[model samples]
Target: MLLEPKSLDNIIVGLLVDNFFKWYVAPKDLWFLDRKKQADAYIKKFKEIGLKNIGNKIEEVDERKGIEVLDENSFIEFIRRINKYAVSTNELRESLKLNLLTTSKQDTFYSFLPSLYVNVDKRELYSLYPEPASYEDFVPKNWSGVYEDFLPKIDWEEKYWYDKNGIDLLNLENNRGKK
Candidate 1:
C-alpha cells in the first residue's frame, strides 16, 4: 500500500534515529582506533574506494556489479559518512549524549516499522518477510517490541493473515481491512 507523505517521512526519520543509535553504541572493537578518529579514517577509505563499490548487495545481486557487500566495515564507513556530512558533529555528539543519559540499552524507543501481521491461530506477530530483515533492507537488526502505540490495533477475531506481498488473506473482497 502507498504511504502518505507524512507517514513516509516518519519512516525515514525512524530509520535515521535507529541507525544513529546503532552507530553510537557499536562495539569499540569494530573500530581499532578511537571512535572519532576511526570515523575519519573510514570516511577517507570510503572516498579512496569510491561510491561505485558502496551499495546494498541485494540491489546489485542481478548484475553482480563489483559492489562491495555491506559488511561491518562498510556499515562503519557509511555511518561515518552520515556523521561527518549529514549532521553537525556537535549536534550528533549532544544527541548521542542525551540518548545515552535518557535511554536504556534495552529501550525500544528507536525501533520503527510500517506494519506487522498477526497470526491468530498461532497468536503471533511477524514481519512480511519469511526471513528476518537485515540492515541492508533498511530494517534495524536490533529493534525489538511492537509499535502498537502508533499503529492500528489488530482485530484478532478477524483471523487475518497476510502473505509475503502484504495481501490480507481473509479480507480479499474489497481489501478494506488490510494491515
Candidate 2:
C-alpha cells in the first residue's frame, strides 16, 4: 500500500517508541510480569512518557520544514527528535532493513515491502514462508504433486501476484470436482 508521508512517519515513530519500551523500559520495569501484564505496563509507560502525542510534534516540524516526503535522513531526524532512547542511525537502519524498509523501487520511490517478503539484498525481495516440520505439514499429501508441479511456473517477479493466472487456475480447479 502507498502510504502518505505523515502516515509513514507515524509508523516509524511508533516503531521507535515500541523499540524504546522493549529495550529500555521492559527489561528494568516489566520483566517479572507475564507477557500480557508486561504489555499492559508498557502501554501505561508509553502514555505516561507523552510518546502518544509525538505525532502532533512531528506535524509541526513537518509543516515548518515543508517536508512533503520523508527520505532517510529526515526519517532518522524525526526518530531522534521523538525518541530520546533511540539507537544510533546505523543501528536503526540495520533494524529497518527488510523489517520495515525495502530496496525495491516503485517507479522513483523506494517501496516499503510487507513483512511477508524479506529484502534479501539491494536488488530483490524474497518470499518468507513458514518452516514446517515436514513436507506433508507444509502442503497436504494430496496437493503435494500439484504444488510441486506449479511451484516452478510461479512468476516470482510479480510482486503483487505470484501467478498472474491464479484466479483462472483456481476456478478451473474448483469446477473440476463439481463437474
Candidate 3:
C-alpha cells in the first residue's frame, strides 16, 4: 500500500546533480526560468484543479514556509512540459535532455490503476470488475467484441459442500476403511 518513487528517478536525479552541480550552487538563480518555483506552482495548481489522481507529497522547508519539497510526479511533469515546449520551439534536443521523467516498470503498472487503456482483443465491452466477473445481459454502451474464445474455460469444483450434519461431505476420512 505504501508506494515510493522508483529507483530510476533517484538515479537520474543523482546523475543530474553530478552533471549540474554548479547550477545548484545558487538555489535562487533562474537560468531555467525559476523551475523550482514553477514546479511548486504547478503542483499547487494541479491539486487545486482536482487532478491529484497521481499522489503527491511535499516536504516543507522552514524558510520556504508555503512551498513544499518537490516530489517525483511534479518534477517529472515539469520536465515533460519543458521538453514539449523546447521541442516545439525547435530547441536542440540536447539542450533539454533530462532523464528525470523516464518511467520504470512500476510506474507503468501504477499508471494503469486510475484509468484503463487496454486493447480489446475480440470486442464485447468488458467490465473488469465484479465476479466470475460476468453479467451476460449487461452490454456496455460501447460494445467491443469479447475474447471469450481465448479465455481458458473453468472446470468448477465444489470447494465447500456441506451436508445435512454441517460437516464437509467431501472429507474422505469421514467414510474410512470400514466400508
Candidate 4:
C-alpha cells in the first residue's frame, strides 16, 4: 500500500531523483550515453550516503525494501497533519529563546505568512497563517549533518531573509503618517 512520502527511504529517493535530473537531464545533453553516465555520478553519491544496500541499479528503485510510496489522499493527509502540528516562525523563535522548544522540533518551524498586509506598527495583528515547510528558513532533518559538527558563526543581529522573495507588504516602518 502507498503511504505519504515522509519515510526516510522516500525522502532519500526524492533527493536522488532531484539530484539526478539536476546533474543530467536538465543540462540539455542530447546524448543518452552522456546523460546515463552523469546519472551514475548521482547514484554513486546516493550510495556513499548509506544507501548501498539498495543495490547498484537505479531501475530497481520500485523494488526497494524500504520504499514507502504515498497515494494522493495520503499525501494530502500528511500535509494536513504537518500543518496541524506546525508552529509559526514567531512562536518557534520565542519558544526557542525561552528554552521551551528544542531543535528536535525543528520540523515544526512553520513560516507560511499571509499575503494580506495590515498597515499598523504599534497595532500589528498576529498573523494566523503558517508557512510551508519547504521555506529555506524552515530547516528539515534531511539536511547534511555537516552543520551539527560546528557552532553557528553568525550573530542573529546580522539580519537576512530566509524565505526567497518574501518581503513585508505593509512597509509599516515608513507608513505611520501616510495613512
Number of the predicted model whose TM-score against the real structure is largest: 4
Candidate 3, superposed: residue stretches over 4 Å from native: 1-9, 13-39, 47-57, 60-179
- Per-model TM-score versus the true fold: 0.20, 0.17, 0.15, 0.21
For residues 1-179, what per-residue lDDT tens digits would candidate 2 score against the true structure?
A: 12211111212111212222211100111111122333344566678987664322212232214333223223344344434333332333333343334333341122222112111111111221122211122221122111122222222332221123333221212322221
* Candidate 1 runs further than 4 Å off: 1-6, 9-68, 84-179
> What is the descending TM-score order?
4, 1, 2, 3
Report the number of the highest-lDDT candidate. Answer: 1
lDDT of 1 by residue, 84-106 (tens): 22322233334434544666532
Q: What is the C-alpha lDDT of each candidate?
A: 0.30, 0.25, 0.25, 0.24
Which regions of candidate 4 are displaced past 4 Å?
A: 1-42, 46-53, 56-75, 100-179
Per-residue lDDT of model 3, residues 1-179, tens digit only: 11221222210111021122100111111111223444555587788988875433433323334323222223334333223122111111111121113554344322211111112222232222122313222222343423232111101111112233434232323433221
Model 4, range 60-102, lDDT digits (tens) per residue?
A: 2222223232222233343333232333334423332333133
* lDDT-best of 1 and 2: 1
